[model samples]
Target chain A: MTSYTDKIREISKRLLKEGKVDMVIGFTRGSVPMMHQPMFAKNQGDVDRFVWDGNCGINLANYVTDRKEKIGIVAKGCDARNLAVHIVENKINRDQLYIIGVPCTGMLDRHKLTASVAGEIESIMEDEAGKTVTISGNGFSETYDRAAVLQENCSLCMHRNPVIYDELIADKVPEQSENDVDRFAAVRKVEEMTPDEKWAYFDDLLSDCIRCYACRNACPLCYCPTCFVDESKPQWVGKSIDPTDIRIFHFLRAYHCAGRCTDCGACVRSCPMGINVRAMTKKLEKDCLENFGWEAGLTTEQRPPLDTYKPDDPEQFIK
Target chain B: MKNLLEHMGIDPGRLHFSWISSAESTKFVEVAKKVTEEAVALKSKEKKYMKTKPKVA
Candidate 1:
């Protein structure tokens, strides 16, 4: 596989040279050493500043969606899918975009991966042998086995291939999860538990929460200009660390995001509280898939499953 | 998610990770320290594992 640096340079050069786009929103090495964040390039000098690899991990769709100009983006599989969702949401004008699709195996969890080779990480790049990550530290340079060093999500990604893009970089990768797992099956199992047991588990879990709203901010579907949590007219959820308020906060956010959520797993990853709230989202995704035969954002013709309702729809479990 | 983080090198006993509706930080700092220690320990293990490879079979 070609390194993203080369691919991004080629795409940027072409976009500028052909006058096909106005700007390139990609990623480069972060201002902080060893970190990676989104980088925007408009001029040729900045094109050389672009870099792509597992390290270009942040979903850049949000940046592009928030803007109103003609822009080409460096999108990996997930980022591209998110862009598709944004397109359907009407948050972005699809015609204005020139998507440079890059197939992604997955992204490394930077904190975990960097610390794994702390004081190393001389240069990060990929090649035919897989990720050619060369790390030099403490008077030694060691090469890590690419696949093993890849992020956890990359190993089990169902959509390594970009769903939509103007260009293709590699042969599309296949979906990873196929089993029709009853998403509500776990919730049902919990329902069977005594109320005491249910709360016991919940209490055990939420006790570590240090209320940082990373989940809300990370979500692409949660595009409310003003969230209910911040509204003081009703004081929707308590300001302090009240446990019930926390519960209500998460439940409301997830419900608001229901049907809209793409199950990108971004919310869970962004949570400093470490709540893996994706469990709720996965359940919602399964419901959308099984009942309405819908997967969010894959098609422009379909309405969000929760947004539409039928008289005969199953409400047996509804209180 | 707990299981997944464990793979990333978090030990629940020390670095308690859970949903917000569940926290009881009565001993917040003590608990935080324990969690930090565990995370650091796991990171160090990854450092060792990643740095040196065993003899190939």
Candidate 2:
């Protein structure tokens, strides 16, 4: 994706030089391998530090909330969706910013890559043309098919092109067809389990949780000024890493994102324990899609299903 | 909230929602009876989310 990086630098430089925006948000290589950190470029000089590749998994939309300054942001498919959500929520105005949209071809899953190799990965190289990834550490170097290591949410993504943008970095990539990807396959598997079995499934899944809140911090949807977990007056969830507390935390967090989540996979990516947190959120997403014929971030003009009242809304669960 | 809780393996019967006004006393009683029956049926299953003594310490 060298061309992507070059184009981003050129655009960001021009935007900065023209004083169109006070800052530009993008990704830069992180301190470690297979991790990219969000970089804020306030001037033309810092624009060169911006880079884009498979490791640019951190959603840049998380940084733009409630900002007063005019901004230009590098948004991939998921980030752009989150931005649309932000605009709909009135967190930021559309006129105050410029969106540099990039057509995304999924990101690599660090957990999958790390698990496939034996030692610490020293470097990672992507062969965009060949659709292969090469990783080297110490005396070992190995290559693997890119599709095999793609993030789970990305592989199942139907929207690989930004839904909204001011400018495009490349021609829009073909989106994944619904027939090609069963986005709810994992949720379906969980749904098929008995209540006791499902309980055990999530219990085992959250067993490694450290209550670090990395997932919440990483999520662009989690922009609450006072998150439920931190509210001392009404302690909705215990601070301890008790299984019940962890379960409640996950449940509530997913609930909060009910109609707003884009299934961007930021929570799963940020989890230090490698927990698949999307399992809970995706169920809500699936329900929203099936019951309400709604997909979050697709359009800013319409409010999400949960946010509005409709007489025809399903009430099958009601007595 | 109820749908998600059920999706996570909680018994669908454990939680109930109804839209009965105070004027509709008969409907309220019927809904309450159904909810109680469902909760009683699930009494055999172990409580899932109740807090217990810390496992870490």
lDDT of 1 by residue, B1-57 (tens): 222222222233433643222365655666567667776765633432121323232
How many angstroms is the interface RMSD of candidate 1?
15.8
TM-score of predicted structure 2: 0.97
**Per-model DockQ against the true two-chain complex:** 0.02, 0.73
Please identify model 1 stretches exceeding 4 Å from their true place: A32-34, A111-128, A131-152, A177-198, A273-275, B1-57
Candidate 2 ranges beyond 4 A from true positions: B55-57
The clash tally of candidate 2 reads 0
lDDT tens readout by residue for model 2, A96-167: 879999999999999988888898999999985739999999888999999889999999999989999999
Docking class of predicted structure 1 = incorrect
Q: Local error of candidate 2 at B14, Å?
A: 0.7
Query: How much is the lDDT of residue A251 in candidate 1?
Result: 58
lDDT of 1 at A228: 91
